[model samples]
Target: MSNIIAIDSDIDRLARKLEHEARLFAARSRNAEAPRSRSWIVVDLEFLFDRSRYEAYSIAEGKDAEEKIRWPFHQVAAVCWMKMEFVRGEPVPMIEGPFVLAAGEMNERAMVSALFATLENNPDAIVTTWGGEARDLAVLRRAAATLDLQLPHQLIDGSPYARERLDLCRATCVQADSVHLPEMAAAVSVPSKPSPSKKIGVLCEAGDWSAVRDQVLADVLTTSVLAVRHLAAHREIECHRADTMTAIADATLSAIPTSGFARKTFAPWARGEKAASQLRGVVYRAAA
Candidate 1:
């Protein structure tokens, strides 16, 4: 296992070196203004499992518990991703998606392959996550290896794209343990996970894909809003810009059908955005 990790590290280094040369050549070839827009892909994944299948072996035995006790998994149930595009001079990025690739609909291998294809096609785009380096990506690596699949090199450690990826948990964590996504959402006053992730496994077992999709979608939206809020709080962008981002996210959530699980899941966020807008208006008038 250590050897595999070492090999992946070596591959990432080589890819980075080649990519750096390519970027230098491109920069010399074109002295144009920076591209008008760029994007970040925010991802969250949920696993599918059945406890009865693992009843024979204790939690410590069935799935490489010795090496990866943090996330021992047999399958990825869903892959949810969002693309936020930032136009130069714009206050906030436009939110494009919180698309779900359900394993039940397309099969696990195919779903993973689709995500890998998306990442490979967008080498320049940043990949954002709450704690992906430790959990989501780790689980994907193991799943890919078991399935004889290949992941995008940019996702590998030490790639030139290392700086292009944002692990929000790493950004905010002060200690060894990561701050949970829901807690961060609460801190930033954004919509949060509608249900515990363990509920995903339960839903999957019951073939409740719609509910699972809605839950994962809510999670990705929460992460996206939290990213903008984090940036503002850290002065990466102005607070007003963060407000714009939050408003767009709320709109995206509102567009979901009222009968769907997300409408109820994000009702609090919708109410909050309305109230916040009113308060911002008063503050602007007072300043004027």
Candidate 2:
């Protein structure tokens, strides 16, 4: 028999109870007009860029000189992946093959096209992500506006949305709740160390390609599985405590407010209501 590692027994039990609560919540939440089920599409974006070539554009110190100017063209390479997870079954991610686009390439259209393709298969699916509500989706929207693509699907941010509705963290913390990113990677048997790249470009450097790809995919898969577990069980694992299970649950719940923007943007989605804009406005206002 195959040995199955228990992700978390306590969280599992809590999840069962939570599922019961979720069902009741759903039942009460539904009016005569509400749909019987809510489908979801989770998305993650990966990009590879050559920073070596861009570093040559540095300017001498001066008021007129900018720190780092945007490249004339980004020499951008990107991949967008999606998966539809219902309340049941094994999750299979549908990934769009990586494409090379201009640094100036508008991403909004690409993101919308990718989402619409997923929606075409499941029209009722809500577009979701750990931080997509604040960051990823917003980036896509801006790119779409620049590229002229119409976004598809209603948006739901997993992190803040879950916190507001269920008092939980989004999938990232849930997946990493019981363990650190490195530990989670190990649990799933992913072979790559975390990168120091603060930006995707640096993260995706050619030197770190193999490890980065493995780590990124591992992170994505780990988070996806955690989200499914949360949905199915209704309770999160706290990973920080001495008791493995409680620690996992606590970690899962504690990850909710890590991002202020995510908290603000996803508040509506947690309540099972469509956000006025599939995207939520950023919490910090900056003069551009």
Tell me each candidate's TM-score. 0.70, 0.43
Which residue ranges in model 1 land beyond 4 Å of their true spot?
A: 1-36, 50-72, 158-161, 235-247, 250-261, 265-271, 278-288
TM-score of 2: 0.43
lDDT of 1 at 93: 71
What is candidate 1's CA lDDT for residue 79? Answer: 84
lDDT of 1 at 213: 77
Q: What CA RMSD would candidate 2 show? A: 19.3
Steric clash pairs (candidate 1): none
lDDT of 2 by residue, 1-288 (tens): 223435476668889999999998887775444543444444555554334544443433345544553433233234333343332121322222212221234442453565555556665555544454444555555554556665453433334454222221344465555334345434543222344324556655444444444334433433444444456565322121112222222222344333222233222222222222234775332321
For model 2, the superposed segments whose C-alpha errors exceed 4 Å read 1-38, 48-76, 87-112, 155-200, 203-215, 235-288
